[model samples]
Target: MYILIRYAALSGKRTATLFPDTPVAVACSLLFKFVLNVFYGTIVVENEHYIPKNGEPVIVCSNHVNSLTDALLLVTSVSSKKRNFLRLTAKDSQFGRKTFSSWLIENAGTLPIQRRKEHGDQADNSTTMDKLLTALSEGDAICLFPEGMSRFHPTMAPLKTGVARIVSDVLTRNRDNPEFAVTLLTCSLTYVHRWSFRSDVLVSFNPPLKLTVKDTPSLISTPDKPVDFEAIKSLTTFMHAQLSSNTIDSPSWDLVRVAKTAARIYVPLGTRMRLGDWVRVVARFVEGLAKPVEGTGAGTGGEGVAIERQGMKRTAYQDQLNALGLKDDRIRQSITLSRIKILWRLFLRICQTCLFLAIAAPGLFLWVPVFATTTYKSEQLKRSGPVWDTHDEVAQTKLVYGLASGIFVWLTAIILTTPIFGLGLFFTIWFVPAWMWLTLRWTEDLIAAFRAAVALYRLLWVSKADLKRLRETREDLHGRVMNVATEVLGLPKDPEAEFLVVEGEEGDDQPSRWAKHQRGRTRGGWDSALRYFSIRRRRKRDWNETLRWFDATEFPKE
Candidate 1:
C-alpha cells in the first residue's frame, strides 16, 4: 500500500495529517510503495533497531544525496516504528513555489527553513525552528539533512550548524527534567550506480545518540538558555564524525573507484558479499587510501604525492584490465576455472539470458519510450547549466520527470485503448505496473547474465602471456592496498574478515558484490584516455560544486 502519513504541529493544531490506518491513506501508501520499489530494485535498511520503538521524540539527521527523495525514503524506511508520524524540514523555496509538488510537500508536514545563500535578505529560519521545537516537544520525530543541500559526492560535505543548534535547544529546554529525553539518529544513505534507475539503495541508521539532561552537562546551566555557539559547534562536529563512520567517505571519485576495485579483487574466492558488507569493505579501502602512510612527511606535499602515485597506479591497472577484456573480479575468478568449465558456464549463462530476454521483451516494448524520454530530459537539463548539471539535479530530474512521464503514458494508453477494451482498460492499472515490475527484473537478470557470458567467452581468447602479466600487476596492487588497510588504517590483514563487520540485516537476497567496470577497448587507445580525462574534468567541476557549502579551508580547493 502507498501511504503518505505524517503529523506535524502547525499553529498549535495538527494540519493536513493523514493517519496511517485510514483507508484512503492505505491506498496512497501502497501506491507510494509501488513507485519507490519500482524506481529502486532493492532497499536495504541497516540498524533499524536504532529507531526508538517506545514512542520517544527523535531528530533524524541524514546526509543529503538524492534531493527530495532522501526524506521520502527515510519516512518509508523508519516510520514503521512506534512513533508519531515523522515530520520533515524542507527548503523555504520549495514551499514558495506555486506547484503541485510544493503544495504536496507543505501538506505533508514539512517545515520550511530559509537558507541565507538561496534566500538572500529574506532568509529567516526562526519560524521554522519554532515549529520544529514545538513538534519535538509534542513527541514527534523530525528529519532534516544536516548537509543543507543535496549533491552526489563520495564523501559528505561539512554539515550546517542549524541541526546541532536545534538539538542543543531541545536539550537545554529539558535539562531540568530527568524523565524528558530526545534521540539524535544518524542515517547514512548509499546507492549503487546512484543516478541509474532500478539500482540498489542502502539506508543505514547508526545507533541513536541519546540526549538526556543527565548526560548533557553543558546544557544544564539554565532552562531558558540562549543557543550556545560552542555547544552547537561541538555537537555538529560529533554528528559529522558519527555519520562519517557509517558512510564511504572517500576524498574523491577517483579514490572511490580505486577503493571499489581493491575491494572487488581482495574479496575471497568462492564467496559473495552482500551489498551492505561490500560497502563496508569499500569504506575500509577508502579510509586506507585517503590516509597518509607512516614515515610519509605529513602535510609536506609528500603525502599528496604518495596518494597521487597510488591513484595513477590504480588508473593504469584499470586501463590494462580494460585492454585485456577483463575486470578485477573476472581475472581473479578465471584462475580457478578450467577451460571446459568456463565454456559450460558460458553456455548456461547464454541460455538463461535468452530465457529472460523473451520474458522481458513485452515490458521493454512498453517502458522503453518512457525511459528514453526521461534520459533525453536529463541530458537536456544537464546541458542547460551547472545548476542542472550537478549529479543531484540530474537524478532528481530523472525521477520526477520519469514519474510524470509514466503517468502520462499510462493515462494516454488507457484513453487510446478504451474504445476497444472499455473495462479492460481499468485492469491495465494493476497489470501494467505488475508486468512492468516483472519485466524490469528480468531485464536486469538478462543484462547481468549476458555480460557474464561475454566475459567467459572473452576469457578463452586471452593469451597466456598477457593474462600472466595482468595477474602479477593485480597482485602487486592488491598487496599495496592491503598494506594501506593494515598498516595505515589498522584494519585486519584478511579482507574476508572485514566483510561481515557491518551489523545489519541483509536485503531480499545477496546479489553479487562486483560492480560493472569499464569495458576493455581493443582500439582507440588515445581516444579512450582522452575520453577518460574529459569525464574526470567534468567530475572535478561537479565535485567542487558539491562542496559549495564547505569553507574554502575545509577541503582542498580542487
Candidate 2:
C-alpha cells in the first residue's frame, strides 16, 4: 500500500502517503552539487557545525533570495549520511504543471502546498499540513522557505505563517511523546554576485532553536481544532528576527559596493577584513544612516546629512581614481609600483598567461559548446524574466536558467564523448567538466593580472605632484566619512585614533620582505601591493572594530 502511494507521487498524482526515494534523492543531490560547483567560484560555509549532528526531527528555515539556488544549496550541503530523509515544501503550481519540473520535484520528495484559491474559493491546506506533520513525525528533515517566494531584494521579505503553523501542528500531534525533539535551524545564503557565474557565496547556519510541546503551549492546536492565529503570528515574528540577524541586508547593491570599497580604505593598512565583517559593517552603516535624528526641526535632516556625507566620500574616492586614469577595479588591483617594476611584472604575467593557455587549449575545444549554450540561455532568461527594474533580479533569472541548461549541456557532452572515445569513455565524460572548472578560475586571475598591467601602464602618465594631491584629498575625505559614521553610530569621538596606522614590526624595510614573501603566494601582479597592506602579524581594535557594536545592537539576535 505504501509502495503504491509512493508510485503515485512519482507519477505526478497527489497521494495520501508520500515516501521519499532515497536513491533518487541522492542522485538529485549529486546533480545539484555538480551544477553549483560549476556555477560558483567559492562556496563558503560558516558555522556548519550548528547543523544538528543527531538528526532527531529538524526543519531548516532559510531566507529566499536566489530562486531555486537557495533550496539547492541547503539540500546539497547536508550530507546524506547525516540526514537520510530530506524533503522540501514547494508551491502546488510547481507540481501540477505535468512538466519535467513536476517529475523532478515529485521524485525529490517535495511536498506541494496549494497557494491559490480554487474558483474564488479557498483551497484546502489541511492535506498539506497533514503531510508535513507526518514527515516530521517520521524524523525526516524538512527544508522550507518561510518567505514563500523569492525576490531580488537586499533584505528578506516578510515571512509567511506556514512554517510556524506546521511547527505548531507537529508539536500538538507529538504531545504524548516527551522524548521527541524538534529543532528549527536557520540558514543564510549571501551571494557576492547572485546571478553571475563563478561568483562567491557565503552560507551561514545559525544555532538551532529547540522546541517541545511544553515550549509552545499557546501555539498548540488539537488535530481537529484550528491553530491559534496570534500564536502563529508571534512565532513568525520570532523566526523573521532570527533569520534576518544571520543574513546581510542592504537597500541597494550600489550602497553595498561603496561601503565595501570605503571599508578597505578606512581600515588600517596591514589588516584584512573578513567578508562577514564587511557585510555587517555595511548593514550597520546603512541602517544607522536611515534612522531619524533627534532634535531636528525637519524630519529629513538625518537622512539628508547621511546622503551628503556619503556622496562627498564617494565622489572623492572616484575623483582620485579618475586623476590616475583608473577605476575601482584598478584601484582594488593594488598596483603601486615604478615603471621599471611594472614592466617586469607585465613580462612575467604575459609568460604566465602563455603557459596557462597552452595547458587549457585542449579542454577549451571540448567545453566551448557547453559554455556558449549556457551563456546564450542565461542572457535570454535574463531579458525575458520579470527583472526589468533591477539588475539583481536579472542575475537571479540568469542563474536559474543557466543551471537548468547546464544539466543538458553536461549530458550532451557525456553522450557525444562516450561514443567517440568508447573504451576511454569514462575519462572523456569527466574531462570537459574538469577543464571548464580550471578555465573559470584561470580566466578570473588572468583578467585581474591584465587589468593590473594596464593600470601600471596608465600610471606613467600621472605626475608625482598630482598623485600626491589626490592621495591627500582621498585621505581627507575618508576621515570626514569616518567622523560622520562614528557620530551617527554613537562611537567614541577620537578623530586621531581613526587614522592611526601601525607600522610593520620590521619598520620601513618590511616592504622588500613582504614583496619577497608575496612572490611565492600567487602569480598575479596585484599580490605584492595587496599583501603589503593586508598582511598583519597581530589583530588590533580600530575604527573598523567599532562598527561591530552597531551591528550587534541594530540586528540583535532573537
Candidate 3:
C-alpha cells in the first residue's frame, strides 16, 4: 500500500520534466535522507552546486566508505531540476534481495552485481563493465566508487581496472564528437567532526576532466595482468590534482588532511541548484525557454466546474514554482502539490518520532550501565580519519567521560529527591526516557542547526546584522550544551582545558585513507571555485575567521 502511494507519486510520462526512473527514487531517497541526516549520524555540507547545472552524462568516482549513506549525501547534493537520468552501480554483499540495504538499492534503481568469493584473483570484471556501459549509453550518468570494498586504509588502494575501462569504452564508443568526451567529476568530502551531531563536511568540487580520443589508451589497467602501475599511477595523480590540489601549500597537517586525504570521496546528485542565484535566474530563463506548453482540452461531456477547478490548481501551481526559484512551466507540472504532500508527511512523521522519544528518554537513562557494556561502539569509530585518527587516548577518555556522566546524573537525582524519598522509581519513570529521547531530540536540533545555519548563511548579505546576532546566540547555545555535558559527567569544568588541543599532534601522523601512490604530490587553485561561487568568497572569509579562533596552525614565518 505504501509502495502504491510512492509509485502513484512517481511521474511516468516521457515528457515529464524528471526522467521516468527518477521521481520515486528521488522522493524516497530524500524522504529517507531527511531522517538519516538528522537522526542517524551523517552530515551533508558544502555541496558543489555548479556541476549539476552544467548537466551532461558523466561518471562520479570516489573511494568507498562504509554503508549506503554515501548515496544519501549524493542525492541531496543534486538539484531536483536534473534528476531523471542518474543511476548507481551497487555490489551484492549488501544488496541481495532480502536485505534492508538491497531494498534501498532496488528502490533507488541501483544495478547490483555479485563480487568474487576470494578478495581478488577470480573476480569476473566483465559483467560489471558491461552493466555500466549500457547505463551510460542510455544517457544515465553512472556513479561508482572505484575502490570496490570498504576497509580502513590511509591511502586509496589499487582501484579495480573496471572504472578506467568504462571511461575507455565510452570514449571509444563516441570518438567522433568532441562534445562526447567522458567527463570525470571528482569530489572530495572531508569531515570536520566525522559521525558527530552537527558535524561539518566540506565537499570540494573540481571542474570535470574530459578523457578524450587524444588521451592514450595505455592508461587503462587490465584485470588479468599485473594492474598497470603507470595507468593507475596517472589516474591517481590526475585525481590527486583534482581532489587534493589545494593541499600543496597548507602549513598544518590538519589542513593538508582536509585537503588531500579525502581526495577520493564521491558525490552523485539527483537535482542540484548549485547554480548561483543569478545563474539560477539564467537557468530558469533557459528552462522557461524550453518548457512545454500545456493546454487543457475539455472532455466532450465533463462538468465545466470540474474543469474550472483543475484550471485553478494549475494556475496556483504555476505561481508556487515561480516562487520556489523555478522559472519553467515544465517544472510546475512535474511537482504537483501531491508531491509536496508526501514531503509534509515525511516531515510530520519525523517530528512525531522525536516527540515520542523525548517522552521516553528518562527510562533509558536508568538502563545506561547495561547499555554501556552492550553499546561497545560509542568511541571505537574515532579511529577513522578527520578526527581521532590516532587518538586512542581521546577515545578512552570519551568512554570514561560517558561513565562519569552517568554517575553525575545519578548524584543529581539523589540530591533533588532527598526530602521526598528514593529517586530510582522517579528516575525509572522519568529521566531514563528523557535521556533516550534526548538523543533523538538532539537529532532534530542538530539537523535544524545545520539547516538554519545554511538558510541564514544564504541570506547573510541581506541580513548581516541579524546574522551577527544569530552567530552570537549559536555560540551561547554551544556553551550551554558544553556546560550541561560537564555537569552530567560530574566533572568540575576546568577553565584551562577549554583551549587545549586534545585530538592530534605532529608525531601521531597516520597515512591518509585516500592518497594513492606514495610519493608526495600536490596541486593548486580556487579561481574557478571563486568565479562560479559567490558563497565561495564568503566561505573563505568564514574559513579564515574559524582558523583564527581555532588557531592551532603554526604558519611558517615569511
Candidates in order have lDDT scores of 0.63, 0.57, 0.40
Clashes within 3 Å, all models in order: 9, 1, 28
> Quick one: RMSD of model 2?
10.1
lDDT of 1: 0.63
| Tens digits of per-residue lDDT for model 2, 1-558 | 000011112323222235635677546666666667666644556565566643377888888887667777776666544555456766666665665445656666665666654223566668767877887787766788888777666667889898887888788888887666688888877776676555556676766888887766776776576667998898788888877765567666555545555554544331232334334455555565445456445674665566555564366565457455564433433336666876788778677667656765766665566557656766665566455233344443444455555556667777777767755468756776666656654554455445545666676666777656666666666666576566665433442343232333222211122111100011123423464222211132221211011101111111
Best by TM-score: 1
Cand. 3 Cα-lDDT:
0.40
Candidate 2 or 1, higher TM-score: 1
State the lDDT of candidate 3 residue by residue for 1-558, as single tens digits: 001001112333222222244565666655554433432222323224435432355777654432344444555554445433445655655455674434655666655455765436656657656756765555556666666554322234455665666776776566555555567777654433323323333444556776665564454333543334576567656765554432122333333322211110101110111211111122222222223334435663224333432332223322232233222211212234343453554466456546545654545555466346423544454434434232322322332344345546656665666656565566554664345445444433434333323322233232435434444533443343233223322222442232111222211222222221111111114423443222111112111112111212122122
Tell me which of candidates 2 and 3 scores higher on lDDT: 2
| Residues 388-453, model 1: lDDT tens digits | 226565655666667777888778776777777768678776677666666766666676677668
Q: What TM-score fits each model?
A: 0.79, 0.74, 0.43
| Residue-level lDDT for 499 in candidate 1 | 45
Please report how far candidate 2 places residue 424 from its true position, in Å: 2.9
Ranking by TM-score: 1, 2, 3
